[model samples]
Target: MEKFPGAEEWVPARGGLPKVAERLKDCRGCDLWEDAEQVVPGDGPAKARMMLVGEQPGDVEDKEGQVFVGPAGRLLDKALEAAGITRDSVYITNAVKHFRFERRGKRRIHKTPAVGHIVACGPWLAREREIVKPELVVVLGAVAARALLGTGFKVTEHRGEPVELPDGTAAVATVHPSSVVRSEEYRRDFGLFVDDLRAAGALLA
Candidate 1:
């Protein structure tokens, strides 16, 4: 495990999303950038009411240079629609901007990012939160939960329950969309995921 100084220095003290996105490309805050194709920053309106945060970019997202455009993303879109939450109304990003993976033959299998990676990427997520100031943050898995809420936050225990942060921002945790995509009981799991989203949506309402 390597230690990084974190991304605070790379983040501009005064700028909006565009400036953050542009400067993110040049961040050497962690070694994850060494293998990643590019940094995939958060995407959505500057002042969305909600924000969705995941663990990190997948192979497709790393290649495409976009967030929430993979199979999991497609499922997320469907789930959001089912929850009566418009996709365009929320901002989406990952806790870590780079794609972490293990090469297996011709395939790049997704690897969960270590805590250091999340810590290294903290500044970027903080910047996005500051700029968006979303009414509620939807954390899509344990990694995301840890990034925003802190370590020891468990999605299984608190899924669909809105928790107030130290800053008074609300957040809800749920399994990653990929988990539902990979579930044996796909329909059931997806339905539950939508239910969680709907609960979060209700908080917004």
Candidate 2:
């Protein structure tokens, strides 16, 4: 099998999550390390059956070193509550561990991660999937769909649909929570986003 770009060096050849964390702390596999505050590794149970992956860390996540803790996260929390999924019940992470941004005066505007950035970060995400072995992967955007599914992934066509991988793990794609925040029809779009999350959670029932 072909190995992902930085997997062997970054993820443990032997250890578990802690080891992954250690390598991630000093990862220089990509230039994203030069600008971001730190690696925002996935957070939740060690063996969660459901994994929720997003695009990348936002400004808040970069500063705090936590996944989904900003405006987007707050919205996700609300939707998850409505969906009957507890925050602690699943793992949450980003497609890219580091924040890629363009600095404006006082703020760092989020820049969509280039393909190379995602390719470089693939190993860490693969390791996360390997370790967690989730029964369900909820990809929360086109970026995440591409990272977890493939380059050809289209959220518009496949969102909320359960796709079975060759390995037999199940994944569903959806709009990132941030999209709802950016949408002009926040209320309507937010409802649809919650519906998608509810469907993903339904598989567990």
Candidate 3:
């Protein structure tokens, strides 16, 4: 199976945020657990007001077993700062918890999680939402949008706009920080990215 059948099997009986993470540490939800150093579970408060979801871990994140500690994460921090959002104000996690990669020579290049992987990893996200119950869920990049919104959702068409989730919580779609890093127009794209964060922040008031 590309994705795990569900995250429930990995969930602890207590089902607290910490237990969720502890259980996830041993998750074999999908084959991703086979290669990664560890499962990169969500990081932040148990009841954070906002939750940020990215696609998957990058090179640095995979090694560190943290969701956002690398370049893209640093960039995301800047965008959040520019938008008046503090690091403590949001819970951050990846839509897929593992790093899927392909090795070339000495480098392990990041590979996008396939649709089946996304579907497989759906349970952890649901578990995170159940635990945090955030007022807003920010979807960064197409992969997250696909997992939370639907496969048909596109960040380009929906960026900076708030949409209602099936659970009724407000969710917003935006580009991943990696996209801005890759953009030729870093300044321009970063500005737009910050704008999207601001929109998400505005709803907090």
Candidate 4:
């Protein structure tokens, strides 16, 4: 197996996110890259005005090598449509590029990447932001919120409110679609989640 180039030694040679991502194909900044079948990079038009950031790849996503193509992804698609946003119009990615998990029999349990892991992966996330330079960023859950805004940022307190980053970009926090699906009260939360997505969509409009 080919090892990822060390983060310290890796430098992006081009100006686009895709180009940067190509370089990350050999990324070994963290151990997550080792077990992951492949790194899932953000996908969408280069000029998209909105960027959606999720926590990390799930089982199906890891296997498919795409962002948000699983159950949570389906929910996201529905929510985006309800919000009057086309999935193809915005960029979608994760805080962590690789999927981290524990194997339980035949199933792969999703594990949240650690702070150090997220920090190690920050450069890639930052590069995506720089390349896309979206007008607004929607953080899908706590992990993305922490990755983008630092550990001090709390999703509960700051969710639904837009915060300005140092780069002058605006960001809004919201629960991940998976959370809604996991809840016993899916109907209520799903409505709220769609509403939040609509709100985020409106910002771009």
Candidate 5:
């Protein structure tokens, strides 16, 4: 395991997300960073009212050093626009900063980050929430939900409902855009995901 920087001692002195991102460049708090090209920080308006958190980076994201630029991201952009939510109006990020993957021939297949890894990277998420202070937090899948709430979070049962956080922020759970894209039943589920995005948008409005 890679030795990460001490999370307790590495508080950011500068304000805003960019400065926080600068701090993350040297993050050795978890082993994921060692293999990851670099930490992918959340992007968008620092003063956005809504923040959307997904699971983690994908192959394209890891290569491009930007969040949500792949097929899933394109879908997310379309859904957000359809729901009357501008992409620039919300902050977007992943629960885990690094892209965890397994090599399969020439392809790098995505691997879910373990709970321990999530916990190890929790401090960065916390820092993001603090800086954004968004009115509504949209968690796009169970993994993101679990990282924000707890392990037992059930996305199927809880999706579209707003849950209040201890920090006075409201959170909404929904299917990840990538899941919607991968489903053979995308026609049926895509509408539902769009509805969920609309609901999240309403909360922000």
Candidate 6:
């Protein structure tokens, strides 16, 4: 077993979004960066009322160096609209900054990031949260939920529920938009996803 030094040292002691984004490019936090095309940092306003945290950058995001611009992201935009939230208003990022994938011929299939990868990239996420200071954090899927909550946290058991973070910010756990995209019952699953987002939105009231 190998030990990771983590991203703590790579993180700026105190800086705004631009500084963090600039420094993030040079991070050798974990092995994920070795195969990834580039780091996908959080996007949107520096300060937002809500923050959407996903698992990691997907294939499109990895290549484009942006967060949530792929199919799942498009689905998320629709879901957010359905939930009465605007896409541009919230900060969007991932628990892991780099894309983790396995190659098949020329296509790269998405792979769930290992725990080490998540741990290594936590500092970056923390800095984003500090800079954004969002009143609410919406975690998309098991990975994001576990990253902010705990390894024992179960998204299935608590999806759509408002939970408390260590910093006292509210958090909502829901299935990732990619899951809805891959579902056989797309309409039904998407409806449920929108419902979860609505629940999260209600907390803002």
Estimate candidate 6's alpha-carbon lDDT, on a 0 to 1 scale.
0.93
Instruction: Please report, in order, the local distance difference test score of every candidate based on alpha carbons.
Output: 0.93, 0.86, 0.88, 0.85, 0.84, 0.93
TM-score for all predictions?
0.98, 0.94, 0.96, 0.93, 0.93, 0.97
Candidate 3, residues 1-205: lDDT per residue as tens digits? 3545656587665567788778888877678889887888789988899999999998899899788998999999999999999988789999899999999998999999998888888888888888889999999999999888886788899899989877789988999999998899999999999999999999887
TM-score for candidate 5: 0.93
Off by over 4 Å in 6: none
Candidate number with the higher lDDT (1 or 5) = 1
For 1-205, candidate 4 gives per-residue lDDT tens digits of 2243335445374578768767878888878977888888889988899999999999898899889999999999998998889999999999888999999998889998887778777778888888888999999998898888877888878777778766779887899999987989988998888878887877777
In candidate 3, stretches whose alpha carbon ends up further than 4 angstroms from where it belongs are: 1-4
- Output the lDDT of residue 202, model 5: 79
- The positional error of residue 125 in candidate 5, measured at the CA in angstroms, is 0.9
Off by over 4 Å in 1: none
lDDT of 6 by residue, 23-137 (tens): 9999998998899999999999998999999999999999999999999999999999999999899999999999999999999999998888888889999999999999999
**Prediction 4 global C-alpha lDDT:** 0.85
Per-candidate clashes, comma-separated: 0, 0, 1, 1, 4, 0
**lDDT: worst 10-residue window of model 3:** 1-10
Model 2: residue 163 alpha-carbon error in angstroms: 0.9
Cα lDDT of model 5 by residue, 111-133, tens digit: 98877777777788888888888
Candidate 4 differs from the real structure by a C-alpha RMSD in angstroms, to one decimal, of: 3.2
Q: Report the lDDT tens digits of candidate 2 across residue range 1-205.
A: 2233554466676677777777899787778888898888889987998999999999999999999999999999999999999999898888899999999998899999887788888888888888888899898998887777787878989888888755678888899999998999999999999989999998877
Local lDDT at 194 for model 2: 91
Evaluate model 3: give its TM-score: 0.96
